[model samples]
Every structure is written in structure tokens, then in C-alpha cells.
Target chain A: MKKLWLLLLYGLLLTISSISLAEEESAFNWQFGVGLGVSHNRNLLPAMDSPRNGIPQLQLLFDFEYKNWFAETPSLRSGQLFGVRSGRLLDDFTLGYRLSNSERHNLALIMASYHDGFGYSVASGDGISSSKLEGLHNRESDFMPGLRYQFYTTDNQLLSLQVNKDITTHHGDMLRLFYGFRFEQHNWDLYFNSELSWYSAKLVNYYYGVTAAEVRSGRPQYQSGSGWRWHNGLVGVYPLNKHWITELGAGINWYTQAFTDSPLTRNNPEVVSFVLIRYVF
Target chain B: MFFRYRLLLLAASLFWQPAQAEALLSASPSNCVTLQQGRECHAQIQTAWTISQPLTVCLYLDEQQLQCWHNTASAQWQWHFKDMQSRQLILWQMTDSEQKLHVLATARIEVSWVQSAHKKRLWRRF
Candidate 1:
């Protein structure tokens, strides 16, 4: 219900922009772009060998200006609206404000309400429960109130830092902090994102509820413990002849786990590599 | 008398042509360029006439930023590449702001750059 209303409100706002046949005139430009990319992250852990492949990612970004809409607003702190799917649709509708202007240094305030929702099926034979939320069903709204900053060198290379607390919990509390950077080239652009997610053993014990047989799989380390997953990938789009783009990419990911007084300690390593052809107009 | 008003409307319609152009433009070979290394090669493009005004849609290699315009008296236009890569087999398009038309076309260019080696009696059976 919240997601639907938000989409409706944004749609109404976008419709108003088309009233004028002429583009808007201002110093700070308000632009919108929609891109669709398909990615799959495979689990190579010996205990968890199921290939959870095929993730259709949709990205919609906006540049909303408060002072000027057309002039040069060259910085990372510009307010943005973004979403993510870590197996759950995390719709983050945030109104961010830039704090610093220096390219080498910047900070921003991110006030977003994250609608965390996920649904899956479980077989009775496997002794798993299968249930889904109906209209306004098992839903939890998380206030992702966070402040992140960026530091860079004279060359403008990016160095980032972010720390946020997850207020959605049943047992204890969950905390997360992430840091990464961006690198660009004439023939390609590269961005590396690394995130460290920690789940309080008390919080994990209440959610995963892994069985004894599942515990024998040696995957008990990540069940109620802490771990870090590293996602390092580079995507390059070179012009083929003006109308199309030849996209080449390769990425590597590794996750290490430390369970809380559990019977499993799993160190997982995975790799994803593919090439795609894209058209940009 | 109001050229400004007319141009604004023209641009809007041109940008909107991509929705319909997908149907007409989606037909193409999956892989068109099969050459490893190459010398200069040429490719020709022709389009159906849809508008009265001369539609000079520019040609782009990988993006619009790196492109050249084609002045066609008729709807059909042609372009050539001096040097080609594997990406050359990819599709090319013709687009303009004046006419509400978008032309997407692909070409199968099997090039022969081994002319000098073929001239040798040791290699040629002839």
C-alpha cells in the first residue's frame, strides 16, 4: 500500500513536467532515468549449494533541485531516490540534502523509510512453514535514518564511509556499515562497493531457526553470527558505433561467517562473469 | 510566424517515436560483425520514407556523442567505417529531431583484410 501510493504520487508529479512542450529552464537540472539490469549471485558454500540465480534489477534515479534545476550541480551529495533487492524489495524513498561542495570532501543526510518485504514457499514434508502477508500483511517499516560521508584525493578519486542502524528487530538490534569507491576511465567506468552487515546473535537466533539436519550442513556459522561479503566488479561500456554499446564485465564475491555458539563455520567464495549488449539513446 | 512553437512540438514527437520504432527496429541479426582484425570497411543504410522534410539522421558508432550526420535527399542513407572491430557487427541507427522517425538497421560485414597475404604464390593455389 505504501509503495503503491508513492508510485502514484511520483507519477502525478512526472505528468506535470510534460505540460510544457519546452524543457524546463534552471541552473540545477531535474532529470530521471530508468535502467533495467539482470544479475545473479550464486552461493558456492558446501552447505548451501542451491543456485539462487536470476535477479531482475530495476533502477530509477532522479535529480531534484531546490535552488536551480539546470545549472551545474556537480557533486555526489545531490538528493536521490534509489531502491535495492537483496532478495527483498527495499524501496528507499529518500529526500537527501548535500552538505559539502568540495569534490574531495562531501557528506549527506539520508532520511528514508524502507519497506522490507519478502515471500517464499516451503513444503510441509520439509517441516518448513509457508505463509505470506496479504493486504497490509506481515509488514515492517524501517526508518533508515543515516548520515554518510565521502573523502577523496586531489585527483577526485572517491573514498566513502557509511554507518546505519536497522531499527527493525524482534530480539536485539542489527547494525551495518559500508565503504567503497568509484574509478573512471576513457574507455570504461569502474565502481567497487563493499558492505559489512552484522546481525546480533540474539536477532539471528530468532529469525533463521535452522534445524539440526540443516545444522549438520556446516552452514550454522552464518545462522546467528557475523560475516562480511565483498562485492568487487567492473563494468565497461565501449561504443560500438554510436547507436549501441558493447558491455563487458567481471565480478568476484566472497562471504565469511562466524556463527554464535553454532555448529557451522562456512567460508564461502563465489564468482559471476558475463557480457551483454546494450542500447543507449 | 511562430517557428519556436513548432520546433518544440517537433522535438516532443521525435523523442516519442522510439516506442513505435521498437517494433520496426527490433529485427536484426544477433551477431553481425565476425571479424577479428580489420582494415577499412564500408556499410550502407536505407530507410523508408515517412516524412516530407529532409531527415538528416546522424550516424553514431557506440553513442550519439561520437557520430556523424548523413544528408539524404531521399529517405535512404548510407555510411562506411574506416576500421572495424568485433562491435562493428552491432546495429546502427538513424535519428533526428526534426522528423518523428528512428531507423535501426544491422549489417552482416564479412571483411577480407588478408589481401597482401593472398597475393603470395606460397599461399594462393592460383
Candidate 2:
């Protein structure tokens, strides 16, 4: 039923966008594409093996804009592809409206999916045997509405900050800060970015806490506190032509002790890397 | 007497008739489309024109002179077109006797794009 509602919302947005296009074609723009890639990653949770081998990745790319309204997929590192697998056709998709626009500063109101939830049975079904994450309650992904602010230090440098609260599920809130620098060399666009995210105690505990009923052998009841995670990455993109582009990126995510110490997680930092080729339409 | 009158009328008609003056102008690949507005669209345009008489003619793009021919009946030129907006190519005849310029023919070059370039660059993934 929730999926039905989301689908209706998506259809409504598309209808409005088409009307906008009919009214002023020059003010509306859209791009759609598909991408295939291979990724290697270290699992952040105890449900998956650490340093997992190369996994096939498939992605659908869609971007839409009409005047101050825009819709796009959430950034790669936010939800770990969980939204895609959860029957959310839009999967961490964001719908936003620009509240302020200036040469160096921008502000927007956005609604998006910020994190992926977990189910113990789903983890076990994916080849886990006698995992410590067993017996934990399922965590449902949250849909958050927030505000984003961006500042451009220069033409090639950007700093962004966002704050969001879960209004649909756990009512937990999060804050994220990101900085990126881009440069072009020999027709290749290279970008370097660093991000820091802070999760509220309620949010962390909902995902990482071990309840009394979930206690097992060598696992005691534990409650998690608010914590921070850091990430840094470099990505490069080269346009093969007007319709084709290739991209490669690698990133590392470091979890604070408050998260790593949880029985549901491991202490090792996560590493994610991928290379993709896409044809734009 | 009637045959003689017909012959005289034909001779007068032939002497009074004026020569036909024609001018033609055209551009090959007259339209250019780009991915975004305000971006430079490049094209190699072949502009050709013909005139009935040997008159000095000059080609002007909008208000800028691109090329000129000296008392030529016809001419063709390979032009490098690079611009962000549509423009008109006008051919003008320079009359030495009247000390004035007369328009011979004109063609239009149109520029269009799929998207507007004025969009804000925010939340761009990749």
C-alpha cells in the first residue's frame, strides 16, 4: 500500500513536469540513462562478509528539472543500494524545490531517503550462517524531509550542508556536511569530495541497538548513542561523446566507535569502488 | 498592309523589352542545433549566390561584412560559422553610378538547442 502511494506520487510529479514542459519547453530539461558496473566493498554490518568481492551493479539514471523544481536519485553512498532492492522504484529518489538561488549560495527544500534498513532473515538468506545479527528486529528505512544549503567557494569548489528528520518511520534526524572540488584536465572531469554525517541517538539505536529480547550467546543487551561517520572519495568522468560517458570512483567510510562497537557491526572501515559506462538520452 | 503592320509591331516590342535581372542566394545546412543554449554552435556553411549582371556585391552577416566580390556574376564561399544566436546573411549590390547600396538577396541562419544553459548547478551526481 505504501508502494502504491509512492507510485502515485511519482506519477503526479511526472504529470506536472510534462505540463510545465508544454507551457515552456525551453525552461524544462530532462536526462535519462542506464549504467552497468562492478563494485567491491567492505560490509558495514555483520550480516555480509567483510571485503566482499566484485559485485555486479546496475543503475538507472534519471534527472529532471523545470524552473525551480528538480528530481533526482540520491547520492551513491547514502543508502547502500538497499532502497533499490526494497521495491522502491524511485529508490532514494529526491524531490526538491530551490528556495534561494545566487551566484555563490543556494538553498533548497528536499524530501529523500537517507538510509537503508535491515532484516535478519534477509541477511541470512544472503548466505549468512549463525551471524551475530540474528534475532534483531527489522529496521525500516526512513523518508526524510529537509533543507539543504550550498556555498561555492570558487567556480570549482563547493560546500554543502543538510539537515533532515524522519517523518515516516523512526522520527530520527541526521545532519550531513560535504565538500567537493572539481577540475578538468584533458577532457576528463575529476572530482574530490569529503563528507561527514551525524546520526541522532534514536536513529542509531533503532538500527544498531541490541534489545533484551534479541540477546543471545555472548551477546548482551546494548543501546547505542549518537555518532559520526566520515567519508572521502575521488571520482572522474570522461565524455566519450555527446551521448556516452564513463565514470570511475573510489571511497572509504570510517565509522566512529559508537557504531563499530555495536554487536550488529564490525570494526573495520568500509571501502567502495566502481567503474561505470553510461549512455545519456 | 496588315502583314507589314504586324512586322513593325513585333520589331517595336523586341526593341522596348527589358533584360531580366535575377538574383538568388542560399546557404547549405542553414540550421544548427546544440545540446545547450548559449553554447557556441559550429558549422561550415557554403554560401552561394548568382546575379544577372556583373556588379560588385558584398555579403554581410547581420551588420558585419564577411566577404565581397568585385563585379562578379556568381560566387560561392566556404564560411566558418560560430555563433550563439541566429543571424541573417544579406547580399548587397554596390552601384557606382548611384553611389548607393541595393539589397540583392538574403538568407537566414538559425541556431537552436535542446536545453537551457541557465540552470543552477546544484546536487549534481557525477
List ranges where model 1 is wrong by over 4 Å: A1-27, A34-36, A44-95, A99-101, A111-119, A122-143, A154-156, A169-186, A193-227, A239-250, A259-267, A270-281, B1-126
Score residue A219 of candidate 1 by CA lDDT. 37
Q: What lDDT does candidate 1 reach at residue A164?
A: 47
Poorest 10 consecutive residues of model 2 chain A by lDDT? A78-87
TM agreement with the true structure for every prediction: 0.44, 0.67
Candidate 2: residue A134 Cα off by (Å): 2.3
C-alpha-based local distance difference test score of model 1: 0.38
Model 2 chain B poorest 10 in a row by lDDT: B117-126
DockQ of 2: 0.06
